[model samples]
Target: MKTMEQIRHLYSRAGFGLRFEDMRLVEQLSVKHSIDFLFRSSVQSKPLVSVKENVNYKDFLKDDQLSRKMFMMQQRQQEKDLNIEWLKNMSTGNTQLRDKMTLFWHNHFACRTLNAWYAQQLNNIQRDNALGNFRTLLLEVSKTPAMLQFLNNQQNRKGHPNENFAREVMELFTIGRGNYTEQDVKESARAFTGWGFNKDGVFAERKFLHDDGQKTFLGNTGNFTGEDIIDMLLAKKQTAHFICTKLYKYLVNEVPDAANVNAMADVFYNHKYEIKPLLEFVFNAKWFYNEKNTGNLIKSPVEFIVAMNRQFYIDYQNPDIQIQFQRALGQVLFYPPNVAGWPGGKNWIDSSSLMYRLSIPATVLNDGVIDFTGKTDPDDEAFIATARKEKKAVHTRVQTQPDWNKFLSDIPAHTTKKEIAQLVLSPAINSKLLSIINKATDIKTMVIELVSTPEYQLS
Candidate 1:
């Protein structure tokens, strides 16, 4: 791959993206040096906004019904704020590798915590350990109140073991399905009894609730604690393969290649699940920049929105605009549809969603409105409909203003449309896109045309 294309690939997958100047600065570096710089630049995590103001759930229950209702209202808004804060960070934080890995783990260990405090806590865990060991990440995430509460491990007590946590730990988090059986789930649930959190969202154990009896799990017999069960799961080579396979799909291609996955599993397992080494291996491999892998993956909604902001310097005038766009696009941050998180890949686009996705660049840059009323498509005015709201149409005026002057002025006056298209798009501009780009009258028109194409939807 050319230097510019290589840097763009790294930035697109590892980080949200880079601006024209940012891309120019790194395009001269060798791929290895660029990878080093990317990792080095993201060594320190950017600060996250405080999403949890109140953690005293114990005291919260003592309050009257009205007090609880008011508190819940405040909490719900805080959750929304947390959602928007993360997006802004993704757009501007410069901690792309960490943030992107955190996003990967976010879905892998998916937990739909309704409480903002617990959700933020879990989010921190993912961010903090995004490049750390997988064993540590899994153990820490498993113990979080968000995971416990969401998976109902909070209710896993003696005599009545809740197997939801055990089942997901295998089926989703590690080893995948068919590696363990219903009996393993039952035994693991028994081991995890007494694992519950206090009102402060701290891990707490109810000794009386635990069953301290010999349990057989995955062919091992012992009085395994919840932590011990996690260790046992991690000890298996299959766990390494499961995580590497998912990582391969997330960072490389959605379709798994057995050879690549096997090599990844070797590096990941041999390193004792160290995240950095595994990623370094993947990034250093020549195949990572191959045509099939470079621009084939679909960008999630978060990625799509951040790319627009990072590339074009778009500003959202309204607080709820991101969430509204997320809802309309099918991938809302912090709100996974179910425990499996977003299906991703081809699931991100269908007949209805493709129309919305294709229209985002023009809609946001042109200050157009989006009508999420499950109605007709947007027209030439750059909106699904005008400000008029139907009886059931969810409407929001997308208060996005793109700084055309900021982006366009940076480019040299002599730059051609093809060069600009190369900078803006991950995929090489094809005949169709080249035709559209060539028809543009000016830089602003050319850029808008470049980004609005369907090819821009892919990385």
Candidate 2:
């Protein structure tokens, strides 16, 4: 049986699994001390944004047509450059846990950055509210400049309401659909009237455009504003249950057992929607350390990358290569596939992706390269020529000097391939794959094989 501390470390490192060092320390401390340390230390990662630089809402609309177009173009360029810098920060950030949790919130309240400026704002909001209160996080995200623009809440008005934000708030964020009615959505939409981004892409509530009229939402009638609507929605028991159930799937296992979920809901609801309290409850619970929960989840691409980075203390000096590396392996920074975010676990593996994931570590470590040239046709001369050119580019331009010594030093010397495989992969391993690994002459080959396997996708 895994120690409670080891379980925490596994959960943190693997699927936000705990760091082994943290686990060791926690074992000597009280649960209260351990829980406090996790949260307190988890937020050590400095945000990409700083304390100054006020975002003036009026700045958004100052540019005239020619200037506005020019500004927008400039913003795109800035974002491209900024993304590389942010990647560097994420790679070397002090607070790995906070960055990881911020990513978790990003997927939960999904937003796509169409432009650079809005995208940067979206990223900052995620970092700001990552370890904070759930209510505050929800409110900030709702009123955020990027979110308002993304969800079409900027178009919400008293007379002509846009229901996009309201619909998502129910379906994706708060109640997860079926819990709210069409009438409820319609009413909630009205409450959010005049919630929009200003000229500077900062949140601004337009009073003249807002609907102050009495509205009925979820059987409650009043002169409700957007905040009031949020309050009411959160007050619902179903909201607590929804959030708790999702947390179970994320932190424990993909599937939620009824008894576990209900127990979480009871604690979450009783605490007036405090996330930290509920997390403590879950972490302290016996089921979280159950053998079934161990190594059950497949690490998301980000999780996999972060865990590897953490384990090896690896840092790439080139931001572009690091950023491009993730893009090649899938899970590009700041770019989620859709509002639902990356479909994690088994969904991360397919023929195309699995090969890349398997090859990426060696590629990064050994300075290997992959040709993206015309590998399309079996017998096309033009494609063959393109493939040759691309291969040349890969060999020459994407140059890297892999350090095997560092990689070897990172893992235990006496650790068998099977033990390392269990550390990296999940519960089950294929016998055929195991046989292939057994044939690997050395640790490096064995490491590559384990990572290359279908099982490595799991935590």
Each model's TM-score? 0.93, 0.81
Clashing residue pairs for model 1: none
Instruction: Count clashing residue pairs in model 2.
Output: 13
lDDT of 2: 0.68
Candidate 2's residue-wise lDDT over 344-386, tens digit each?
6567666766666676666555556664332232223444575
Please state the error at residue 43 of candidate 2 in Å. Answer: 3.4
Model 1 bad stretches (over 4 Å)? 55-69, 375-390, 412-414
